[model samples]
Target chain A: MRSSVALWAASLLVYLFLYVPLAIVVAYSFNDSRLNAEWVGFTWHWYQVLLHDEDMLQAAANSLLIAFIASTCATVLGTMAGLAMHRYKPKLLPFMVITPVAMPEILLGVSLLLFFIQVLNLTLGMLSVILAHITFCIGFVAIVVKARLAGMDESIFEAARDLGATPWKTFKHVTFPLILPAVVAGFLMSFTLSLDDFVITFFTAGVGVSTLPLQIYSMIKIAVTPEVNAVSTVLMLITLTMIVLAARFAPETLKARS
Target chain B: MATPAFADLLKFRLHKNLTRWLVSGPPFLFLLLFFLAPSLIMVLASFRYPGEFGGLAPLRDANPAVLQGLTLETYRFFFSDVIYAEIFFKSFGMALATTLACLVMAYPLALLIARSPRKHRDLMVLLVILPFASNFLVRVYAWMIILGPQSAFAHAIGSALELFGITPVPLLFSPVAVLIGMIYVHLPFMILPLYTNLEKHDPVLLDAAQDLGANAWRRFWDVTFPLSLPGIFAGSALVFIPVLGMFAIPDILGGTRDMLIGNLIKEQFLGVRDWPFGATLSIMLTLMVLAWAGFSMWLARKWSHSHA
Candidate 1:
């Protein structure tokens, strides 16, 4: 009993340590004052500002667009890769497929940037960002989907095939249904990763194509403002909600506790 | 019902080589061109030097005009540079330290959550993981706001400490800030893995130890800790590798003054336009990660084999 109490208290303090700063940011987002700390009154001034901030809005739109395209592409590619890796006996090759993930972002960012500019002669923009994102996102999707595949009953696929189903039909009818939850989970994870990407996007972004993270970073360089705090708060809440939903609804294979 | 019909269609298609190739060809080709080919290009380009006009023109010593014969000049340059060497060593050291700190911090939290009565564990785990779901940069930025000079918490805490005759500590843009941000960002990575492992542990083992007259410390050391090593390894790898590659936290929290190897690589490619050198560094970094990953993979295989 005593140990449990100590544990709970220590954990609670950790929670406060983790969340207090964020709470302050969220609290100040509604502050009527421009200053980050000072709270003159409770008003949605920054929220209102965000409503009309064209640059921020456009950056947000670009971010969503990039994440959507990139994450979707990554999900499809990753699902296929995962399916092949899990079903086939080519274990060593899949490691190479996922190696891009372990390579440092700067390394990847610079190499991809170099490849694009010097070799491919392509300008950076949504296409470059999406490509960069897919590079990393594919690995994430593959890992998650692969883990899910590992947990699935291998006999099910074999059983489907034994009954006279073709490989494609077996995957579509039997394999695909079992893996759907993991695929969704992987997609969400990829989307969030793409949405939150900065260093890679920063190195690869062209002059005019700004992401939300880049915008937030540049804003920080100028000065920390309540509007950013508001945006950060909103972003945090959305992500938190999604993660909780994922954690709760995730299949046994995808659950962290497993 | 539908399963048999689908299976029949799948078996019918499997008889045709064209359909099999069609099913497998695109993903294989995609990975081959985009992933495998690009990495090969990076490796090849790392060995070549840029020529006049700042372009990747070829060196004259090779059979193919564009391909240069192997040169270790890039590697030599990176190794010979004292600043870069220091940055590389320091980044690894910091990553290791951060990993240890997160493990120490995470152990108690995970134990607490795992030990909690059935009703409370889920809530506690949910709260613990909530912050990790936020944008990684925003969370670090939140730290910046809290630790920065203008922080109300900083001022208040400093004043309160002064009342007790203790000097206020300066925290922002220091290594301390980097450690704080890293631990905060990665604590969940550590906690969840440990919790998963610890949850697998049978309480009966502890009871058996007690029955054998082992003290709690001895039991944990002899039984629990050994069982938990895999989690520790997993958690540490998750935290350390990413932290070594981290550019943002050190950039924002440490104010870009304390440059790590990641920053050095970024500077070369983006700032200084030294593509060959950056590629060399990237190759080195990739090699090191692979080496570490290989070691861990071996360790895991050995452990599992022994257990089996």
Candidate 2:
């Protein structure tokens, strides 16, 4: 009984530790004070400031554009990778798909930076950022789709094949319908990932391009205004909504991620 | 008639091969081009020389006698300066510390979540992941406010330290703040794997131990700890490896002396434009991460064997 009490108390503390900072960030967004030091009277001035901030607005536009293109490409290719891994169980494909996701983000960032400058001589910009996002996002989408595929009944595919359906026909009629939710979830996951990505984007984004994360990073480094809090709060809401929607689409995406 | 049947079989075989390629081809080529090729370039980059201006020295040269700028200069430089090695050691130590801190905090939370009713487990886990899914820099910035000199918590901590006769250290730009940020960012990684592993453990075993007169502590130390080895390692690796490569935390929260391997590598590439040195440092970091993983797996196996 004593041990159990200790466990509950300790666990609650941990949970509080996880949440208190985020809650503080959200709470301060509405604080009227310019400083983040203490709570003041409530106001929407900071968010209004955010609306008028040209740099922040431009960064947001760039982030969404990059995420949209990258996640779409990642979804299509990742679905194919997932389907292939589930069906054929290819030996090398899984390794190649997952390693980029598993390795430290900086490794991928550095390697791609080297490749961009040295090999392709490609200028670092939005295109480079989109390309980098796609490479990492593909693995995340593939994992989700693969997990969804694994949870399914394999005999259904076999029965369709036995009933004289071509592989393409079976995939069109049955497989696509079953995995659509997961594919959607995968897309959303990748979208959030691409939007939230920083380190990789930091390396690949040349002086001309600025994503929301990059902008936020600069803001945090330079100052601690309530405008940073306002932006963080907005980003948090978008991520929260995306995750909740993704969870509703394919619940297992959350579980399989661990 | 026989010839037509044979032709039909051949057509079917060709169609199946086409289907196989169509299903797997795009992702295969894409990963090969984008992922595999870039990683290979980095490996080659480590062997090249830094260009005079900051990027790689040109690989091709008109004069063949110039050695083409390929040499062991970066690796030699890394060795000649003990500072680089000390940074690596310091980073490793920080990673290790962060992982241990996460494990200690995560264990109780994971255990509680695992023991909860099944319907509540998902919500509990979601709660853990929500803050994590929020912007990473935002999470670090949150700490900047909490640990800033003007904040109440910082004042409290400063006064508390002064009461102990120690100088009131600056809270935001210190190693302590960096560790706090690391722990805050990485605690979920430790919890999730542990929860997944702990949830799988059979409850009957615990009951069996209780019936056999093993107290709760003994049951946990011997049975639970040994059985949860895989989860511990999983959580540890997830925490330790990322923390090892982390630059942003230290960059935002650390002082002058807190330069880890990550900061060093970042400086090499971005600050100094030394691409080869950056690649070399990355390769060394990779090797170290792999070594840590391998050593843990070996230790886990040894631990389980002894218990058995």
Candidate 3:
């Protein structure tokens, strides 16, 4: 009885440690004081500043567009990779798909930065950033989809083929419906990752382009204001909504990433 | 025509081969172009010279006055300049420290969650995941607020130290603040893997240990801890390696004296505009990570073999 009580207390403390800092950030967003040191009368002014700030607005638009496109492409390619891995069991495909996901983000960021300038001679902007996001995001989507595929009975796919359904027809009728949740889950995850990404975007996004993370990073580095706190609160809510919606589709996405 | 059945079989085989390529080829091609080619470019970039102004020098048909063509100058510089290696050592120590802190903090929570009722387990895990799901920067930013001089938490720690006749140290931008940020950002990565491993453990073993008169501490140390080696490895890899290359936490929270491998690499690319040096530092970091990963896997294998 005592040990269980001790375990419960320890776990609760850990949970509080995880959450208290974030709760404080959210609370200070409403504090009207520019100093942001103590409790003050609640005001919506910081959020208002975030909404009207021209730079923040532009960065948000760029982040949304890049995330939408990158996640879409990554989903298609990553789904194909996942399907191929489960069905074909290609040796090289798994290595290529998983390594980029596991390595440090900065390595990929700088390597791509070099590749763009040196080999492709392509100018860094929205296109380069989206392409970079898609490259890493593919690995994540593939892992989730592949995990979903791994659990199912192989005979079902074989059964579809035995019924004389064409390859495309079998996938369309049998496989697609079963894995649709995972696919949607992968899309949402890719969207979140791309949106939250900073290091890769930092390196590949030339002077002309910016994203929300880049903007927020600059804000915190340059000055500390309740406005950063407000922007952070808003970003947290949007992410929470995305993850909850993703959980509804496939709870396994969270597990797979972890 | 030959036999109709034979002809049909040949066509079906051909179609299977086509489908296989069609299914696998696009993603394979995409990764090859984007990931593999870029990594190779980085390897090549490390061997090249910095241009007169910045970036990589022209490889072919270069002006004699400008730095051009591939050379080993960056590697030589890295060898001669002792500071580069010092930074690498500091980053490794920091990674090790962060990994250890996360392991200690996460184990208790993971144990509780694993022992919890099955239905409630997912929700508990979700609670842990929810905070981390936000931008990691914002998560790091939270530390900045709590550790700032005016915050009650920092003041409390500072005042407590003064009672012992020690000076009240400034908290923000110190190594301690960076370490806290590192532990905060990475604790979940440790918890999830350990929980997954512990959840699969049979309650039978603990019962058997208790039957043999082993107490709780002995039972855990002798049985449960040994069994969870693979989980420890996975969790450690997730936490340790990323910490090795993290810059933002240090950049935002670190004082003037604190610099890690990630900051050094970032400076070369973005601040210094020295592409070759940046690529060299990246390659070195990758090699070190690979070596460490390889060593840990070997150790885990030995532990498992002995336990088995």
Candidate 1 lDDT by residue in tens digits, B1-308: 99999998786666655654564456567666556766777787678785444436565655565646567778888878787778888888888899999888888888777767768877777777677767877888888878887778779978998999999887788888998998888888888888888878888888899899998789879988888889988888778887888888888888566777787777777667677887887887777777767877789778888877
Residue B14 lDDT (model 2) = 98
> Top model by DockQ, which number?
3
Query: Where in model 3 is the C-alpha error above 4 Å?
Result: A1-3, B1-3
Task: Please state the Cα-based DockQ of model 2 relative to the true two-chain complex.
Answer: 0.73
Tell me the TM-score of chain B in each candidate: 0.84, 0.94, 0.96
Q: Model 2 over residues B76-131: C-alpha lDDT tens digits?
A: 98899988889999999999999999999999999888888889888889988888
Per-residue C-alpha lDDT of model 3 across residues B113-202, encoded as one tens digit per residue: 898888989998999899978898899999999999989899899999999999988999999999999999999999999999999999
Predicted complex 1: CAPRI docking category: medium
The candidate that achieves the highest lDDT relative to the unseen native structure:
3
Q: Which stretches of candidate 2 lie over 4 Å from their true place?
A: A1-3, B1-5, B63-69, B300-308
* Per-prediction TM-score to the true structure, in the order listed: 0.89, 0.97, 0.98
Model 3 clash number: 0
Compared to the true structure, candidate 2 yields what TM-score?
0.97
Put the candidates in lDDT order, highest first: 3, 2, 1
Please provide, for model 3 over A24-99, each residue's C-alpha lDDT reduced to its tens digit, 9 standing for 90 to 100. 9999999989975889789999999998899999999999999999999999999999999999999999999998
Candidate 1 chain A worst ten-residue window by lDDT: A249-258
The per-model DockQ list reads 0.49, 0.73, 0.76
Question: Distance (Å) between predicted and true CA of B248, model 2?
Answer: 0.7
